[model samples]
Target: MSLAQWHNKRPPAATGLRLDFDDGGSEHVSTTTTSSALSLLSDQLATQFDRYKNEMARMFQDHVRIVDVVDRVDSLLAAGDGEAAPDCQREKEAEASNAARHGAELEERVARLRAEAAAWHPAVKPPCPSL
Candidate 1:
């Protein structure tokens, strides 16, 4: 999965991410924002957050801060992945497309009927004498 797909943004044509090193060196990333990259970043941040919590526990032994941080992170991740957004727009677009197709079919049928009617003419002879 493309991490960028989470936001539905069109990927840039040139996604070169440049990183500068501390020793006057630099590296360029031709590709980024893949699922693996996101997973790695998430793991690293979680580790750091765990360390922060441990340090706070050592200093003040606060359990409330841990709960608060977990709740905040859960909500943040949900928002980041668009879990709170509705999928109504896609449904509406699909309905509109089906309606357009049905309208086109109706138009074609009407045109065919009109053409047949234009070619139709009254019978030259009377009804059969089967009566």
Candidate 2:
């Protein structure tokens, strides 16, 4: 769904605290005091987390697929059937090459995502006096 629809669909009543920031800007930030608002915020965070997890999984899967394809090709080559050894080797090499490239791309995408996520929200521990 669109973000506008998501933002427009709020709960009937909010029971949580309201937080606002005014930096002398025209934009006004508002939050509700109900659990629903917190829940909504939590859900949004969860969605992002899930997306990250999915990306990671996809990267892993890509690597696994490459390995599986390569292994299949190797198996075919190892069969030693005098008839199609060369053809099998050629086809397997091509498949392996394609899978390797795809896997590399997936890894790069995952790395970029991880870097972006780290920049967005780095892990913190304990309370700091600066805050």
Clashes of each: 0, 6
Each candidate structure's TM-score, on Cα atoms with residue i matched to residue i, is 0.30, 0.30
**For residues 26-49, what per-residue lDDT tens digits would candidate 2 score against the true structure?**
123332334567899899999999
lDDT on C-alpha atoms for all candidate structures: 0.72, 0.79
Flag regions of model 2 displaced more than 4 Å.
1-81, 122-131
* Candidate 2, residue 32: how far the Cα is off, in Å: 96
lDDT of 1 by residue, 1-131 (tens): 58777579644454354432332322323244365688899999999999999898776645677888999998897776664345666778899999999999999999999888777745345778995
Error of 1 at 101 (Å): 0.4
Candidate 1 local Cα displacement, residue 131, angstroms:
22
In model 1, which runs have C-alpha deviations exceeding 4 angstroms?
A: 1-86, 122-131
lDDT, model 2: 0.79
For model 2, name the residue pairs that clash.
14-34, 15-33, 15-34, 16-33, 16-34, 17-33
